[model samples]
Target: MNKKLCLGAFMRPISLHTAWWRHPNAAPQANFDFPIIKDLVRKLEDACFDAVFLADHLAVMNMPTNALKRSGTITSFEPLTLLSALAACTTNIGLIATGTTSYEEPYLTARRFASLDHLSSGRAGWNIVTTVNTEAAYNFGLESARLHAERYERAGEFFKVVTGLWDGWADDALLMDKESGIFFDPEKIKPLNHKGKYFSVKGPLNIARPVQGWPVIALAGASDAARQMAAESADLVFGNARTIETARSFYKDVKTRAIAAGRNPDHLKILPANQVYVAATREEAYRKKQVMDDLVHVDSNLPNLSLKLGVDVSGFDLDKPLPDIPETEQSKGHQREWIALAQREGLTVRELAKRAAGSGIGEMIGTPSEVADQMEEWLLTEACDGFMMVFHSAPDGYDDFTSMVVPELQRRGLFRTRYEGGTLRDTIGLPRPDSRVD
Candidate 1:
């Protein structure tokens, strides 16, 4: 049997490019426009993409004023709200929303995802994240962001509480028996009674068991703590690897960890993010990328760089090489990546920040066949199960990918040409989790 690829569309923020809104053909205010998002989701489903992944932000003040002013991501619909609405519009594509464990209540988060699973008929996925933005702390009434390890620690306990709540009732617990006047079998239901360090969510969620037992658990991050969490819990891991070598290393490390944790490696899918720019020709693709990169202002990149490194780079001279920097409370995985890029490429602070702003996991620029070649190579090499595709611009980039690249992949027998099942777990070949009530 041939290996198959799982593709996800990064829908929220509309585009990862800082200057996405500035593109000449880009849809104005596309991030906040439901019609545009609906259209995009429809396109993704029509092409048989696995999921529409929506990333959320707790604060708009993550960057400096000048940078924040130019950002296209400043205003957007909340992930759950938008995913719930999209659930109504899209039947095939999985709805995956980021729900931060640090700031949100486990009961509320579990209930919302369970409701989404029911609404979408078992097509919901929750991308578990610990909020990283320092400004987000202020919005949640925290004086400062919690340390990275502490956040992950809380996240681990939080997952237990939420999943425990999800298992409140047996799969066959519910029965609408009018004659007996019993809505459910009393003996089949169980309460979690969870008492963890960070949260004490007493179990039995108000809603019935989610359609897929618990909505598919998705996680993202490349740190040691993150890898451990993903190994033990995540059904899907959104990776950030720019090279095949790096990707393969990450792939082996996490899968090995998952195996050690008594999980089948096949159950966890690693999908690195890729910003694709496919056009009629390779040159045209590069030209399109250059145009987008040219629109980004240098001032807008400083705060973004700082956010990733968890240290202020504003004092560093732009023309000089990056100074020896000490890691702080930010994502060690991201901070390490940036430092390595700078040292490896001999890039000055200015050049490094610009490149970082342009593409994080790296861009796939070429014609449909060319882009498909890279994807096929990654999948065949076991570097990743698939990709979380990031479009450079709306409508144009979105259309080109669905119409061009998807068919080429389909022709190569690397991607699914049609839907195989109704639910997300079924669609992705992930097993439906058994109810933990008993």
Candidate 2:
């Protein structure tokens, strides 16, 4: 049997390029416009994408004023609320929303995902993210950001508590018996009574067991702690490797770790994030990318560089090569990527900022056939299971991929022409988790 690719769209802000809104064909307000988002999602479903991954931020003023003013993501609907609305609009495609473990309560996170799973008829997934933006700490009533290790530690425990709550009720727990005045089987439910270093929760989740037993568990990060947790629990692992070699290595490492943790490695699907810019011709694709790159303003570029490096680079001399910088408590993986890129290319501060503003790991830039070729190579070579595609600009960029590239992939027999099943786990070939209560 041949391997099939599992494609997911990284949506919410709707585009990944910093200057996406400035594109001539871009929908500037699409991020906040429900009608636009609905249409885009519907198209993705039509193309048989696996999921729409919605990223979130708890703070609006996380960046400098100049950068904030130019950001399309600063004003957008919350992930769960938007996905819930989307659930009503579409069917089949997974609705994945980011829920922070550092600040959100376990019970609430479990309940929200369970509700979404029920609402979407089991086509829901939770993207577990530890809050990395320091400004988010303030919003959550913390004076300072938690240390990197501490945040991941809390995330591990948080996952256990949430999954435990979700498993509180057996699959047949609710009888809804019309006779005998018995609504449910009292013996079927289990109380979590979870006590952990970071959280304490009493089960069960008020809702019935999710339609897919538990919603698909998805996690993203490159840190060691992150890898460990994903190996132990995540059904879908979003990777960030930039090269085929790097991606293949990451795929092997995570799967190896999963086996070490006594898991079936095939249960963990790894999809590296790729920002794609496709066109009718390869030259046109590169030209479009260059056009988009030119639109990135200095205001947004520098601040993004600072954020990625986990240091304020605003004071650095733009013409000078990046200086030696100590690591901060932000995302170690991200910082390493940026530092490595700069060193490899010997880029100056200004050059690095420009690159960072338009950067994404393994950017696919070419005609539909070219893009399809790259994806096929990655899949066959064990570089990744598939891709979490981040489009360069909204509406047009999305339309191009679906109308152009998706068919190419299907024609090659590397992707599905139709969805395999209704739930996300089925679409991705992951098994539905059995209720722990059993």
TM-score (all chains, Cα) for each model: 0.98, 0.97
Give lDDT per model, in order: 0.89, 0.88
lDDT of model number 1: 0.89
Instruction: Tell me model 2's lDDT, rounded to 2 decimals.
Output: 0.88
- For candidate 1, the 10 contiguous residues with the lowest summed lDDT are 355-364
Question: In model 1, which runs have C-alpha deviations exceeding 4 angstroms?
Answer: none
Give lDDT tens digits, candidate 2, residues 40-85.
Answer: 9999999999999999988884788888888888788999999999
Residues 216-316 of candidate 1: C-alpha lDDT, one tens digit per residue:
89999989999999999999999878778889999999999999999999999999998899999999999998998899887778887887677889999
Candidate 1: count of backbone clashes, pairs at least 3 residues apart or interchain? 0
Model 1: colliding residue pairs: none
